[model samples]
Target: MSQSPTLEEELERARDLSVSDLADAIESIGFECTRCGACCTGHGPEADREPHTATVFPDEVRELQAATADHAGDETGDAGDETDGAGRDEDAPADASTEWRDVARPMPYGLTDGDDGPEGETFEWALQTDACGDCVFYEETETDGETTGACSVHADRPLICETYPFSVALDGTSQPMGEAVDSVTLPARGDADEAGDAAETVRAHECEGLGRDISRADAEELAAALKERAVRELTEAVGVRDTYEPARPGPGEVVVHDSEGAKRPDGTSVDD
Candidate 1:
């Protein structure tokens, strides 16, 4: 197996690439999403919108916060809450909760291909659609004089968007499963026209690296490496683990101790 780069390394590589370069890299990989809406529709049975999984940029977070704030006016500013006219941030912690942390949470359950059912169905963590199942960011556009609707958040779209034509399942291990379509997969539209021709060209470029089938072993290895990197980066980014205080056991709360040593919080330190 080939060596997988650590998350830090990947981040560094990302940082090094210019915007144009980044776009070029994605193109070279054979991903040419035509905004056909398939990715946003049920067509993506195992789609996720998590920032980590979707390559969310720092600016996207800031923009989202700003846009949501502007739209709400006087509602509430929070994950799903609307902003209120009072200018107060609705996402602020109330008198009861612990201090709020700024880091994004781990990617939630659904958003990917898996065998789990009902109780395990995962959903992406982003602006949800009303009844349409479309992304809140999905947009339709028209030429200059006409108002064109489009995902305002497209530029900084999630990591999942970048790694498309391939599915990475982050269960116990990171595994790359073969997507239903590769470059070889013919576009549903007949390939007679220029658009179809271009689509075919894009497909050929993307499938070059992927070995026809998704290898479970490769997926697990990649997942494990990413998990390690994520854990380390998260700990550093949040600095929460370093400051976390283990809960004090209540009375009669049996504390498991090893044969080598034991200690209690009541001013006692014992070593075997």
Candidate 2:
């Protein structure tokens, strides 16, 4: 007898859906700019330092240069200096200003050995910073040059800035605010002063494009791409999982419990 379609095939079919099939769809769909400047400001200099501290991907560095060229003025040559005028050695190869191959070390994920280990490493991540709570690339401008300010690098900003409120990790997966304790808050809307509860905002804006909320159909497309990549990884790339079993808890050893009875390693019990 013939067999039904495989799970992959079914998943593919699900992905073929349209924009309407997604639950967390964006509502008004306005260009993102709360003038909050959260993306610009970071912690301290050590937190936002260059070289070993903050490394930009070759592509992003190029984009940053292009976007801020006009604003950089006489600081043009300073851009090529990896230190970005921080006084680091200018003779380094990584500081040579390669158009695209300039990869920074201390990247997000540590390198995994090819054969005997897990899958490939995750991508590197870095935060944007400047003197204030705004990014160096961030430009604040008003309609008549009399108003307050806003981000100038909105359009060509990195994936991080473009997908604020919803944060994407080193891995490709994205998480909403409530789901994560460390997520950045979404910008406040209208006279509704206080920002919504993290979880509430996440739930409310599930499909809002500004929050990196892709439609179910879009998710399907991405899933398909991932599936293909997975197959390749299993066959060609390094496999992440290793089967060596971990030592199981011994029989009499007191196990930690969340409810009712809790006990010490020596077997003394405590009440809820």
Lowest lDDT 10-residue stretch of candidate 1: 97-106
Report lDDT per candidate: 0.34, 0.35
Compare the candidates by lDDT and give the number of the best one: 2
Reference-based TM-score, model 1: 0.34
True-structure RMSD for candidate 2: 17.3
User: What's the count of clashing pairs in each model shown?
Assistant: 24, 8
The runs of at least 3 residues in candidate 2 whose Cα sits more than 4 Å from the true structure, single-residue gaps closed, are: 1-18, 21-24, 28-33, 43-58, 70-122, 131-134, 140-149, 167-171, 174-272
Residues 1-272, candidate 1: write the lDDT tens digits: 44554444433432332333223323333333445544443223346432222222233434555554444433434444543445445566443221111212212343233344222212112333423555555667767756443554555444444344443221111222223443332232342363322221112223334443334444333334333433333323333223333333343321212111222211122232
